[model samples]
Target: MSDPAKEYKQLKEDFVSNLTGGSIGEINLVTAIVPVSVLLWSVLQKRHSFFKPYTVNAFGLDYLINVGTVLLSFTLYSSQPLLLNALLIVPALAFYLTPPDSPTSRKKPDVPPKAKSKHGATATPDALGALPLKPFLTTYRGSMIVATCIAILAVDFRLFPRRFAKVETWGTSLMDLGVGSFVFSAGIVAARPVLKERAAGAPASPLAPRLVRSLRHSLSLLVLGVIRTLSIKGLDYAEHVSEYGVHWNFFFTLGLLPPFVAAFQSALAIVPSYAALAVVLAGLYEAALDKTELGAFVLTAPRTDLLSMNKEGIFSFFGYLAIFLAGQGAGMYMLPRNISPRPGTTKGAQRKTLLLTMAAWSAAWAALYFFATSYDYGLGLSVSRRLANLPYVLWVAAFNTAQILACCIIDTVFFPESYKAVDVSAEEEAHRGATSRLLRSFNRNGLALFLLANLLTGAVNMTVATLDAAPILATGILVGYTFVLCSVAIVLDELDISIKL
Candidate 1:
């Protein structure tokens, strides 16, 4: 008979893809390959006439830079091996390639539409359709988030990233990148209440209306949480071991915390609200994990298993709430005030204001991160999602702030007129080019894509013996998986269907 312990160890090694040394190289290759494949598909679909030098050349440059970054990361793994960090080069390239008059640049081009629709019916003035050629900074962030989430899911299930790294070891393991991208994006998105309200064309909501909306959103989260929990249990996959080691998947925390976060923000100002929540939650987590009777009880009260998730799992939501609230704080600063295109301010002036704000906030958060981590490093309190302590909060906030700075810099280089084209009518958006269609596909149905990917992860795990697939085969499978998922989002976009609660 096989030794279960030995069998288990091998299973884990295969699952995380660290079975072979130097799995980082493989992971980078997969990341580059998938995006490049998608870009190629977009090119084929758009079919800009073969002689269209500008469009074709721009896309070619993008593809080359993307692939080159992956290879460079792989080759330099010994010196600077963080592939995700290396991938940041793509945005830099994108920003550099965006000339003042380029369609992809921040400056709105005066060029006429490629052509009117066959039916000549006006298309709706949809932000989703505008995502492609003129993606805003936030749009890029959002797209990367979904893409990263999908990539990690593919890796964890052993379809790709066949060489894996442990989550705790740090240095941009696939698991951390996946979870961090999701959580980080969640925080930023949570910060956008003003923008959301304005976009919906509702007059600034009173507290009551906002509360009602928050509650509804919270209810949706709970329902989705239940669905995820039951779905995992039903599939007999809850017990399937993961890096988290706890009863909770990231989704569980995602579901349980958003409601509390929403309720907390209903009264407090964005920054102070999350700050206070973070303080309270972190304190509770520290205290509960102490060596006292209460701590012991808290830790052991609900023993966790596949069948019955631990109550301790719920406590982790406290940390997640802090993270979410912090994200809301980010949104308040990053997004335009009142979302009315800042009347009387030219786009240049608006960009300057945003850049200055991001710079100052980035500096403040960096200081917070340094101080908090210096104090907590000895106590094992740095960047722990389970604790969601001050250091973790600062780190996430600082990292996000830095990314925002990058976005602002990119915007300045590219010239952001597309995002500022807020007053354009619906008919104008419909006649947009292929790039918008592709970007909007992921942007509009983000939640749906996430849900679909989760469902597909489970399905793949159940049907395939993924733990030992060859790296090439696994990469191909993952690329195909992503393409299909992205296609779903695109099709939904075309049909103007968004799965929202």
Candidate 2:
């Protein structure tokens, strides 16, 4: 008789293989959970007295609405995403339409009139009227992390539909989106330090020192990559080698990026914009994949040596780097350089500039995605997460930019006064509700939460025959796993403990 362990391993491998992804519209709707959940929570805070009791002590409610609901959508209701979306939307709309108690309503304080300028407009105040982007960014990123954590282990069970698993070679799925989203999110945040360094006019350092500093910054990721490789090989864990390669993992991909980006910093200066640089890089890589034998080598070459063994990881690095640059461009455009407006710029002008920039960026990315993917009028390339090719990069950029835009719009529409251009004081920040605090916790301890989830996933796989578990049993296990992850994040945040490394 065949060994049960080997059979189980093979079964698991087959379970996630040879699959095509679902529609982009559906994926976008599923992603709506992030912003819509916040909107729903805000409406509840305003309209429901019954919910008021839990407002002060809302950890349970927070978990149920934010974490638990996401878990359900990705598992139990994975097939009926539209129904799931409707359930969330209907309640949020109903509650939002209802009038709030006068005592509970927060009215904006009146501002004293300022002197008029020569243009007959109110003199621009030092502080620009700009909505806070941090909360929206945090929510978007936290939700992505939460979804990744949930899907990592859930994909092992029958309850988690195969449609959501990572595609084999070319296609889209929730899991496929997760990997790119992680890279994109990292790129988005990575922009701040680089821009700040430029703005501060840091003294030019030698390349050797710069390289060393970049490597030092990335040391933890490299170390983790090593540890993960050793553990997987030592434990003989089941792995889909094609996902990265025989020896390579995503941590290595992430670890190597900072140094490569640093090396190219000087070259990048010649390019007018990071977005343009990204397009150039991706275009060149895609041309190489199509015009040369490199594409065949990545897809079908034998694993003869170390280089060939890890070709996918090595080659895909360029595509990921391009994604990173795109994200950096976005960050430079969106994030404020100073707390106040430029000397001569009015609040109205600043707001208009911000909106127009966001819109243009979104439109450009969307157009690129369509052109890259369309066979009739543009490059007829299929998206390949495995290759991290041009189409994949464009799709990720477009999807994320749109999501960011959506979140901003949602915040402006539902909580206008709160997210208004006026600077939010510490007092206003402190008065934020429990749901906001919970979302912030995820952002604060993001890496820690991801690591914990990975460890727990390994443990669960070793302890249980996930493929053999019944649907209800699998779901229960997932619920327990999610609770543990969220609880750890909340506790760490409450204790003001942030694990940077």
Best by TM-score: 2
lDDT of 1 by residue, 1-501 (tens): 644444533433443343222333444444443344333323332333211232545444433333333333322332354454545545444543444233453333336543333467543334333122233433445445455545544555443333343333222344443455466567666656555665577775566665666666667666776776677667667352323333455655665555566556545655355545565665565545443343333323354554334433455456556656666666665655322255687656766776787788779777766665464553433344433445555666666666556545644443344444543442233223323344456666666677778778777777777777765665556656665675576568658797875
lDDT per residue as tens, model 2, 347-404: 4455457656778888999899899978799876677888898988988888888777
TM-score of 2: 0.86
**Model 2: lDDT of residue 160:** 81
Model 1 alpha-carbon miss at residue 462, Å: 1.5
Deviating ranges (above 4 Å) for candidate 2: 1-19, 46-57, 104-133, 201-206, 337-349, 416-435
Candidate models: Cα lDDT each: 0.50, 0.75
Cα shift from native, residue 9, model 2 (Å):
32
TM-score of each: 0.67, 0.86
Show the lowest summed lDDT stretch of 10 residues, model 1: 45-54
For every candidate in turn, the CA RMSD to the true structure comes to 9.1, 7.9
